[model samples]
Target: MSQQRHELLPTETHDELARESFVQALKSHIATRVSPGVREIYDHRVRDRWVSEHGAEPADRHEVREALSADTYYRLWSSVRRSSQHLLWSSVGDAVTRQADDLAARARVADAGLGTLRLDPDLEIPWYNAEVDIHAMPGGYRGEYMAGDVSVGAVYDRGVYVYAMGQMGALNDDYGHSICQNLLAASYPEFTPRRILDMGCTVGNSTLPYVDAFPDAEVHGIDLGAPVVRYAHARAESLGRAVHFSQQNAECTDFPDGHFDLIVSHIVLHEMSPAALRRTLAECRRLLAAGGLMVHADFAGYAGVDPVTQAMIDWDTYNNHEPFWGPMRDMDLVADAVSAGFDDGAVSIETVLTGRVLQTGKQQRAGQLTLLVGQA
Candidate 1:
């Protein structure tokens, strides 16, 4: 048990550690093994029987949901998974509140004046963010109750590790590193970017990896959450990675036109409304230099999915506070890219690697995860 939270009694530290560890262990079991067993039973026994009796399989995820809504196994699995997710955040929230002041102080003195964190007091938080807490996180990502509150950021940083259950690797930067590798090695072997940007970077978990991927490039990350950027800047500085983190909404930024040669986002699009997503894409175009590349990776892995898989995926939308997650999966990403002024031929899906990043990349808009890649 780490005394990571500041000014805490040893008893409090142990209590927090015990409680969060239990939740993380429970979450991992449900996510990796228990949930899969339920799915197996449904696929093998319930689904097959339903298909035989009903004279056809489920037409879509909706049909599957309706059919299995009352099933005991389905109900139990769904409830448990959703509860685990919520518990993960709440547990972190308790710890973060105790450490918020400490995190803020550390951010102020980190690295002895290294890196930058610029937050706008008047920055408008998008309606999409205000309406619902993404991923069941309390107060969402941007909410700050005090002057130098980092509770939301600290919770997110700690919770994601438990939420991911070590699947995201030790640094938790695989999401960005995998995307960068696939794009650099496979998609654009000839392209070498000089400046890079990451949109909606929560704690620079996905932002700092680009610093290593492009050693010579100036890496910048923007998000609407001020505390998260503060934490991200400090984290990057501590790791000796000079990343510029700013609190700016992705839909609009103050950067000069054609400022970045490469722009990327990780798991950001699904949390946005259609209109907001459009504006963000257009903004990407505005921020990108001529011949620059843009890649937005998400968990919209629809490739090879049948009704059963889709219905399982859909549980997150309604239960996890992801209002736009489902629609984002069905969006015509190539058409959207073209509408945003990207070359039609250049608009394509790159391979989304496995063992970490989910499959969204596919030729026909179906894959384990998705990658929307194009040039400005």
Candidate 2:
């Protein structure tokens, strides 16, 4: 199935939609049919060769990569996986570019009087963001081609649904939805937040869930991209969600100290540099009121995974333009949070099952999301 259509999403031509669907199918095939072979090759072929040479299995993800790099099957699969990513973006980008003017116009009139959008032209884009197109997404998240360009945001809103292979639910909102429904409700039943903030809220996919989950709470979302926040505000307004959208760096937002009762981010930490990640955690501490909860959700760290598995998961860092993926996995998030002024006892990492399952053409995959949770 395709992504749920919203006003801010570009209208794909019939052929464009088919191309996007093919890309999705190819990704699903890779995940189900081709990717599983990596483990089999590593367990039997790569491991046998490594043991013959060094008298022990690959010691770390580095060695695991070295071993896999030599295997013809692995190389072929890797090439295909990388190509698929480029194709995914090309397919989505074309659709957005085709209707750039239309999208900008729609964004201009999308307000349903639900929320507000604030932008900062002088806000410097971080070096990390300005230097790389994090996902090889064309023009990245901040590109503004025209006076009121929302094309990049439209592309992202559609692209992520495909990139996640529909595992993030129909609206690509499973992360925020799951956190609110599964984690917060069970953990802090009596804690009612008056103001909530979502950090690195690209296109506001994860930010909108808070509006539905906490109807009375004042919800806000922040991102470094001007185009993204512009589209995010419009998207929220079209969806009847009252979410304040702003263009600001998460590491140094203008919100006053103790301005929020709850802070959350979804899979955004891996996109940041080490310094930014640390500063953001500290910023979260500063923005949160006493007894407030801070939850940054992303993939779990690579402390206990097998070497081969780690290498496999880290392939994105090398192939998909996610430079910080591997480094982010190696970080000690709990310790970092403590260093960010959180009490040692107040922070911990927990893994929670996704509130939804990924359904792909008769295949169902259950997923787990990790949380770096802290309390102020």
Candidate 3:
């Protein structure tokens, strides 16, 4: 019996190493297989369309498309693979759960902290009313959306994307904020913001970045989910960031009129319905101090990309449970922003790379479009 145990132990260790090696190899293989074709598609279809229609320099779209395509492919692949691995992890988690009732106890403690906030579950927020689990998260944000239930919304947000590999889907909201900060700093150097507000900041991921970006300014974040707000506040506190998080709807915020120098939404707009988006935009305009800027970082339609790229973006909306995404992308964001009260010349869309740089034509390419409003 002792000899058998020793032999099995060595075998187990070998298997673990082999599995890890296989995963790494699979990632490398997927990258090599998908990247080149994606790059070609971007260079030909995406770049040509942007330059021809938007008056961007020739080859600009090409370079941008290559970088963006790689990033998108990597993110999508990682998420899918992670989901695949979850079957194993889930069983392991179950075993761990059995062994350690401590996790449950911890979750209960977290739940207690969230109980102070009153959230209206029946309030019927239009943006969250969707049938499909957007981004393939098993339970979408609205599925278990509840106040005082720390595990529901919080779990859904973290778990739904559990299968997503390597911070794919930006892992957490903080990553999204970091992306925004980097994009703004690199793309729009002229805009010096003083007061910033991040809407739908569930965990202050989007809110904390602004605080870091502009230390001189006051940063605030608001969300309707009380548990999420509580969690966000706790997280921010733990991170040693002084961010003011409130439980409120973005459409009708408690903030004073014209209070913020910059109003930003990271991946929040598309979740909203058309009417809600319009209302949010109007609220953004109303809350912006005169000459304050609104920087919205989200999806733009793949009008110029190849059929495959277009299909990939659209597939997530249909297959991955993002019902509003397709509709949101179809809407004219620039037009919507203008209708909300920004001047005609105030809004401009510029692309930035979300992934590694790759070869392209002479023109510089932007990976994703960042719509800057309020000034040129």
Q: Give the whole-model CA lDDT for all candidates, comma-separated.
A: 0.78, 0.90, 0.56
Which stretches of model 1 miss by more than 4 angstroms?
1-12, 37-57, 301-303, 354-369
What would the per-residue lDDT of candidate 2 be over residues 1-376, giving only the tens digit for each residue? 5678788988778999899889988988888788888888988889999999999988899899999999999999999998898999999999888889999999999989989999999999999899888888887888888988998899899898877767777788988988997789888888789999999999999998888888899999999999999999999888888999999999999999999999999989999999999999999999999999999999988998988889998998888778999999999999999999999999999877885565434577678889999999
RMSD of each: 4.6, 2.0, 10.3
Per lDDT, what order, best first?
2, 1, 3
**TM-score for all predictions?**
0.87, 0.95, 0.64
Which scores greater on TM-score, model 1 or model 3? 1
Instruction: Return the top candidate by TM-score.
Output: 2
Residue-level lDDT tens digits of model 1 in 1-376: 2323321111227877678888877875666566666567777777777788799877888878777775788888888888888788877778777766776777666753556789899998888897788898998888788777766777877787666555575556768877777666666787788999999998888887788877888899999988778778877777778898899999889999999999999889999998899889989889989999898888655657887778878888888999898888888888887898787797787667734532221212222346788887
Error of model 2, residue 144, in angstroms: 1.7
Residue-by-residue lDDT tens digits, candidate 3, 253-362: 77889899888777777777788888888888899987787877676765666544554455456445566776887788788888988888787775544532222233
Q: Candidate 3: list runs displaced more than 4 Å.
A: 1-123, 127-132, 142-147, 152-164, 167-183, 187-192, 355-369
Model 2 TM-score, all chains together: 0.95
Question: Residue 325 in model 3: shift from native, Å?
Answer: 2.3
lDDT of 3: 0.56
- Residue runs of model 2 more than 4 Å from their true location after superposition: 355-365
Best by lDDT: 2
